[model samples]
Target: MSGITRRSGLLLGGAALLSAAAGAPDRPWAEWDVAVIGAGVTGLSAARNLADHGLRVVVLEARDRIGGQLYTDHGFTSVPVELGAGLIHGAAASTWELVDWAGAETVRVRSEPRAAPGTSVDGAAPPREDESAADYLRRLGVPESDWPPVSDENEPLSRWSAAWMVERGEFDWWSAPRADFRVVGGYDRLLAPLAYGLRIDLGRRVRAVRWSGGGVELVVSGPGGTERVRARRCVATLPIRVLRAADVAFDPPLPAAHRDAIAALDATDAVKLLMEFDRPVLPADADTLAWDGDLDVWSVSRLSPTAPEVVSVWAAGEAARALLALPEDDRFDAGLRALGEAAGQAPPDPVRRTTHDWTRDPHSRGAYLYVPPGAHDAPAALAAPVGGVLFFAGEATTGENTVEGAYDSGYDATDGLLADL
Candidate 1:
């Protein structure tokens, strides 16, 4: 049992297989030791780890490209502009390891002006597990000035879980004055190393996952035609939103607990944009402008001072939904208006406007994970496998709901799969 590259000696009753259908019997069937779904952070890391350990793993990605939420718009500006996730949560974030291994440049920079620490309203007692942070804040009549940042966590207070806040420990560590770091060139640079030597099939969507005691059979659809893939073990790493949307059906249906976990967790709606300006915008002294407006504006230059003269706008949940509601052209206009208001400058319109609405995206229906009310254990429950044949990995399953958590998910899934084998 030193390694498992083929099913010759390690055939566990049935061999892993990929067979083309739709009158293509002449096509060859590809075999794999394990099949990983959705080439996001979780999927990429898991595939890389499993491959390195001598397992013939194949990553089936729904999207045309990998790096799921770690999307970078290199064409938007001179330096890469992050359309999905930007900052590495904190220096302590485990993604830094990949950055180091990839030899990517990063610096501890300020994303916004440092505000008073903690989301606690008037030093109120910690929130109960049954309530949301919004309800708690509203009950305290939290000052309107502090309403915007919710004392500094990314997701708005309404979507937050009061108990989850306590569980996350420190929000200040994620972003404060120079508390976090951004990859200098692009966060997506790590994609190369993770994808290197990995067998990835892009533009292929897994429509169904039929798992039983024998093995897991995945029905996949692509431009070519319909195909079926059978593997001894399966790693499903789709985003929570995609899972909730029922994009892929499990033949016998996932266990009740897994299904419940998928439903219980909340995914935040997110929209990001980059507006190129003639010169630097926002006050030079200010790293981020915490405004009373609906969006937050940050300097792309801060990622690398010499990078570009553009500002990045971020909108979450209702705000993101609102922006998404606007026409494609109007969305950028709205972003510019929000930026001008936040910056207190009636500056001219941007030269270029690049807007990406994650909420409206089919693949990424929302940004990342968040805990609300009483579903604290949902992440772990969702991460749990079924029949020892199907494993799961994603940020929602990690309990932390961060890039680090998503990356760690791969390790966790691979470890479990290895042990079972």
Candidate 2:
């Protein structure tokens, strides 16, 4: 099958299913060929692919909106400001394909500044073999007093895999500059297409999944009330943080191997603080800045060439936790102060400011997944299907921990389900 309209696919698939169950006893709940949990990139891509194959699929999203981490806040500024996932990463990324399909305008960020020979950031010595980048920097004769207040204490160096870095087009953590890109309208423009012609039920929080029987049953709480949904196959695309937290109980509980995979992986914190200025306040020459202070990275960019000036402050790992611990208004103030200090200019505060603490979001819990030391195969293990009844797909399962990986994992899940069927 090529492309199927939402109405046509629903009508045809429903009629076929009813005909097949004509002689069976009437069931209280509605049945679906496939039930996808979470309307993120992974779930939406899987639902779209399965629907294209003539399967009746329904996506249940706990959030009120469709694009999960691909959220764009129009209220903050006249131009769309991304509160979640922002950059497209690289040209090879699958997100670029969607951008091309949508004909969205994109701007490739300037590459990172190259380090001089035999030196790291701030003229520090290069990393040694088998040494973590963080430890190597600490040992590079840099004074302890010069170090940023936020140390990389809880963050592990092994989390930064070479393959992952390469995929992101970054050759070295301290030196190699990566070329990043962003969508003109918003990252949601690329995601909105994948959700087209697919049944997505927003504000549907999945509380439990009972899959011991022939079919899978899902207990979902939504705006109306709690309801049970039955499906022959179920694809669970919940974030690793949510899964690790055991937010949704599974009947017969997952096997020891699955549980082990969930425990082995790590979900790190990341917070994006967006500040919109009434006028251009940041330096035009610098598109991005990596500070050696409280704020790890500060990126300044425009929604369009002529759009209002906006600065995004990103903090990861322990720094993220520190910022997330503060109250919402305090967090914004801290970020604004940091931006001004870094730019060496007092930022004009005539406009709006916003931020999203992914670590605090109930549905996601954390930003994304990371492969912990000695858990190289954890992603594949987590992605593996359980008794052909429960399938898993997410950024963690893909091992890429990117929007592209999440989108690709959906196709991977659909292929696996189709093979089983």
Candidate 3:
């Protein structure tokens, strides 16, 4: 109480959780039964699972909204246009099982895994030719022999290389590729059902959690006021970037190994721009296109063939960040340019355009986590439990890094916590 003081603060937007100066415990401190930070798919799933089992749980979401990155532009389209997660990835039982549980609409679009025949790397009108992802990589700098053999030694990668990978019973990049489905209204719908009875503080921005003592105490500040919440344990589902920033001060500091993993597995900044055309500019038959540029891929989603008036463009990686840095008018112009370039036709100017600058958002420091080429195992370390109380779970924790993976991690973390208790 000697160091506690009232401080002035500011709130920028819906999900921007900001904090003012504060003096909290720097030494080992209390713990919580469970403190789930973040409210994205992962945090939501973890909190829901824990609460379902009759455990005391509280989900602290830095953003004003619950769904962290499952941003579906329902306002723009009747059929939800996904700005964050677009695919279920594979025909696996877990993700599909969640879909069934959620009771969301499902659609089976033929997976167009191959780059359009003659999909030109040179930015030509037509695509280059039929080629496997491996061939595409080989054409770059990767050696064919260097690739993990398509065998037991590399089951998933091998299966991904199979021609029938996209077809049923064949594995793609993931172990079991399911028919890609979009949550009918929006991915946000998926959040509602899971969060039914969970206790979540929408505007609470957790600044620090000290857990060196018997329990955990979190300093959560928001527009209303700042308060300390206590629990026997805490599960941090905050993005890796937030942890890397040392935003939440730990009592005795994190272990050097955990610190190293957090630094190594820090999330990369990814951007997504959704543009809705007055009329379909690209062929519906072209489900997705993986371009060779600062951008990774783009897909055409005219969910209702009868409604050819709308489609969304998705940009990832450095391209997305670059797009966010541009002026608003320039952003729109650049998207239109990319559309025309991809379709080899004049693209209709968008009737509506929406962009999310997640990088600039304080709550979520980056898009979904990505493991670079080497740090494959680093993610597991970042997720490992600390002192049987301080647990970590999020997109970065799971290797798949999909919505399902995030959900599974939360659920798994909750299960792990309950078992330990």
Those runs of model 1 whose alpha carbons end farther than 4 Å from true positions after fitting are 1-29, 111-128, 134-155, 168-178, 302-307
Reference-based lDDT, residue 412, model 2 = 79
Clash pairs, model 2 backbone: none
Off by over 4 Å in 3: 1-32, 114-179, 289-301, 306-308
Model 3: weakest 10-residue lDDT segment is 1-10
CA lDDT, every model vs. true structure = 0.73, 0.71, 0.61
Tens-digit lDDT track of model 2 for 242-306: 99999999998998889998987778888888877777766666677656675643444554567
- Looking at model 2, which ten-residue stretch has the lowest summed lDDT? 1-10
As for candidate 1, its clashing pairs are none
lDDT of each residue in 212-309, candidate 1, tens digit only: 98888899999999999988889999888889999999989999999999999878777887888877778877668878777877877655456557
Cα misplacement distance, residue 133 of candidate 2 (Å): 7.8
Query: In model 3, how large is the Cα lDDT of residue 214?
Result: 76
- Highest TM-score: which candidate? 1
